[model samples]
Target: MSKKHRREEDDEHPDESWLLPYSDLMTLLLALFIVLYAASSVNISKLEELSHAFDNAFSSGINILDKNALIKATDEQNKHQQQRHEDVGARPNKEQLKQEEQENLENLKKKLDSYIKQNGLSTQLQTQLNQSQLLITIRDNALFPSGSADVKPDAQKLAVAIGQMLQSYPDYEVIVSGHTDNEPINTQEFASNWELSSKRAINFMKILLQNPAFDPKKFSAIGYGEYRPVDTNNTAEGRAKNRRVEVSILRKYTDTATDDTVLDAIAAQDQKDASTASP
Candidate 1:
């Protein structure tokens, strides 16, 4: 009688081994469908994973039952791979940097030219771009008195404007060089042309450095005096041409081969100056 009573209790309980698994499968399917709805456009690999997940969720076969958590782990693994793909482990190469430097110098040249034209200082200011440097030549009379080193108050604006333009390119080496005609000067304030030229360069450089955006180590002042004359000293016109200050923006990158084009431009300019200066 006890055996029969136990049998009756077993029949009432009806083996519920599949119920738990079925409920878990239903939950996974519902979550997967929600994910699918959010990401309607999936790649081929994603579609394959979803299909495999659906097969497992439906209890389709015993073959894939051992790795039931394959889909759950796949998401994390794919995400890790994606992050690695997004990481660009490359930096700009030498040629790329050279190209960028060229473009920047060109742009700065254009800006300077526009500023010169707009300010009606074309006669006193000129720019030359070469493989070696970006040369800006300014007549001494524009920045100083007949024999003075002190910059005229109005000309400080030009210096400041140049300084502001240079702020955009801070890495370059800048040189403020003063030049003068062959005429010898022995004033109370200046003993010789050397003293006058040196002070002029120094004063102009000081004004530029006032912006504080520049690295002082990269800046320098040079005094060429009458040593580097681009024009003849015989005539008044040539002397006027020779007395100038030059702001040379030294180049960081150079071409593999030599470029004599800048020399040609200088020759052409000299011819022009000589023709105009001739009496």
Candidate 2:
């Protein structure tokens, strides 16, 4: 009877097999909470390591936490975004640089114009500041004789003054171009207009380079002969205008069509003025 009573007592208690799964669920929930808390402070790599450890310990191989991967992806995205911001901040803006360059050219032009007007050189020389260059046009009579390539002794002073002014701008490239009228020439020294124009350009450039402040490597001489005339070759006055020398200081920030557009406008204006004065 006692044995029967013990069996009844054992049957009165319930089976506890469900506690095994319940305990496992509770442990997983605790691990998830810990991972979530740590993820708020740590990088993605550490979270991934912790996830692997939890997966190994559980032995069920069931993926209980996908939030770690999500957090890792978010972290990587933020890192890339910050890097892009830094890159953008480090570089200079293109439009700002262009504006600064334009201002610098304008100031230089003002200085040159003031010097020319003060010295009463308006008739013999003129300066034009355009998008691609600063052009200084000089009448041939001011620098050379009627049929010679040699620069006059007194004209050396003009070159010296120009050189002094140019000393302030050491970074520019200066091009000295010689132009002539359509009249052909055959001298003992020069066989053709091309040779005369080229020699004239070279001689004038040499005088400018005499200043110690001028960089010889930055200067060049070219002759367009009668091809690049600013005026007509039909009359004596036009021919006189055509026979000239041009000193071009090339700009550092040049645009593709800006130079041509500005030059064409200036040339058109000059042509209109010349035509108006002709008759």
Candidate 3:
């Protein structure tokens, strides 16, 4: 009975197991896993590159990049901008300076013209007006005796008059220049025209300095013997013209208009005074 029971139990357990569904399920799962793996692995490196590119594009302009290309480009742009700023900063305004210069020159011109006309020195002295400055020309004969560097007594009066006029505007500078003809001088006092001319300029300068209104710091003497002649040296008339002294009033940059408006105003006032006194 025990053997029979054991046989029956074994026979019952041995009932053919239905393993097809289980096997099929396991195979199908393996196939699905394989398909998933293949799809995921396809172009894995390319996908990673694209992701990094997208991140970079979105991150742009937030901060400066340390990459070689970005750094080089940024440096170039900065250099260009810096250069532009320097160019603009270096240029001074032009119109303002010109206007100031004109104004100052006009004032000097009016005063000089009036002096020449009033003293009946028009024949021996003249004033030239130009864009840059005013020049007062004095004939050599009127300033010194023949072959002498000393300023004549009459010349001293003229110098005093000029000094007084200059005192009214102490800000301007006075340039006394001496000019001579081609005639050579051989004397104990002056070996050549150069010496004579320079001495004459110095003498005139001294006379100007004697005046209380004259400032020595504002005066300078220059000698241009036989050079810078306004006329030809070959003729007597030209030589006479060439042998002269010129007192130039330099135009200040600030007095022209915007820069030199002060000078211009002075000049305009001098002109007005002359017109009022004219016959």
Candidate 4:
């Protein structure tokens, strides 16, 4: 009877049921710790390689990563790479624009020189290149009478030829500058060289604008009037050299930052001088 009772009690009690899930949870926790340790202690080069491989696997349009976390990392890396590529491509366009502008200016200078040689006007007109722009110089003796601002009838022919050649180019800002030797002027029409230089510049500009092809907005007349001399005024030949007009064509879009800064400073100083001028 006792043995029968013990058998019944054994049937009622079975093996523990919770052990399977508990052991599985322990195993998963152990695996997570191992992965974390491997990530923290791996060699840097190896880590980079792993990261790259992971990126390729996930974002290569072939999602190989079984876990979702690695795919997000790959997306971030892809976005970063795309941004870098875009940033790198941005500068070449600016460089190309600068190159095009430089080539265009050089061509303009060449044309000016060719025209000067062909016309046999080398005695009165000359072309040159400097850091700033292409300069086509016209001697005062060729363009105007002594102490007079009027451009001679003969000089108008020369201006027409220049205007025709310059019409081919419409990009540049043209500055027409009139300069005179350091000499005092006493005349019925004008008491100062400044007035004479300014009037001469205006008349020359008018001649140039007569062509109708050269834009008036692109042109400006400035009188240096014995200032900014290219040669010494001590000798008659040097003074003659200094008494001249220059047509300067600017050759840059955004490349003339330094030149523009210098010009701004000069303009400001000129304004100050005019304000302080005595009557």
Q: List model 4 lDDT by residue over 1-279, tens digit each.
A: 999999999899976778999996786577557655766965465467556655675567444334675666557667866887899887578768867877777887788788778878788888876556778999999988888888888888888878887887776789998988878897988778888788788889888888767778988999879876666677788789879998898766554676788688778866654443322
Model 1 alpha-carbon miss at residue 149, Å: 0.4
True-vs-predicted CA distance for residue 259, candidate 4, Å? 4.4
Q: Itemize residue pairs with steric clashes in candidate 4.
A: none
| Better candidate number, 2 or 4, judged by TM-score | 2
TM-score of 3: 0.55
Give lDDT tens digits, candidate 2, residues 1-279: 999998898899878999999998898899789768867887666576666656665687745556675576567767866888899998878777778767776777787788779988888898888777888999999999898988988788888888888888877899999999889898899888899889989999998998888889999999978767677778899889989989998888766688678789879877775564354
lDDT of 1 by residue, 1-279 (tens): 999999999999999999999997786677767768845876666667667666765676433333547655476659855875666335666788888988999999999999999999999999998788899999988999999999999789999999999899999999999988878899899888898889999999999999989999999999877767778788888899889999999888776553466577677876775564454
- How does residue 245 of candidate 3 score in lDDT? 90
TM-score of each candidate structure, all chains considered together: 0.62, 0.63, 0.55, 0.60
The candidate that wins on lDDT is: 1
Tens digits of per-residue lDDT for model 3, 116-204? 88889998998886544578899999999988988898999998887777666677778999988878889999988888889989999
Name the weakest run of 10 consecutive residues (lDDT summed) in model 2: 270-279
Residue 7 error, candidate 3, Å? 60
Q: Rate the local accuracy (lDDT) of all candidates.
A: 0.84, 0.82, 0.75, 0.78
What lDDT does model 3 reach?
0.75
Note each model's CA RMSD in angstroms. 12.8, 9.7, 20.4, 9.5
Decoy 4 TM-score against native: 0.60
Q: Assess the local accuracy of residue 175 in candidate 1 as a C-alpha lDDT between 0 and 100.
A: 95
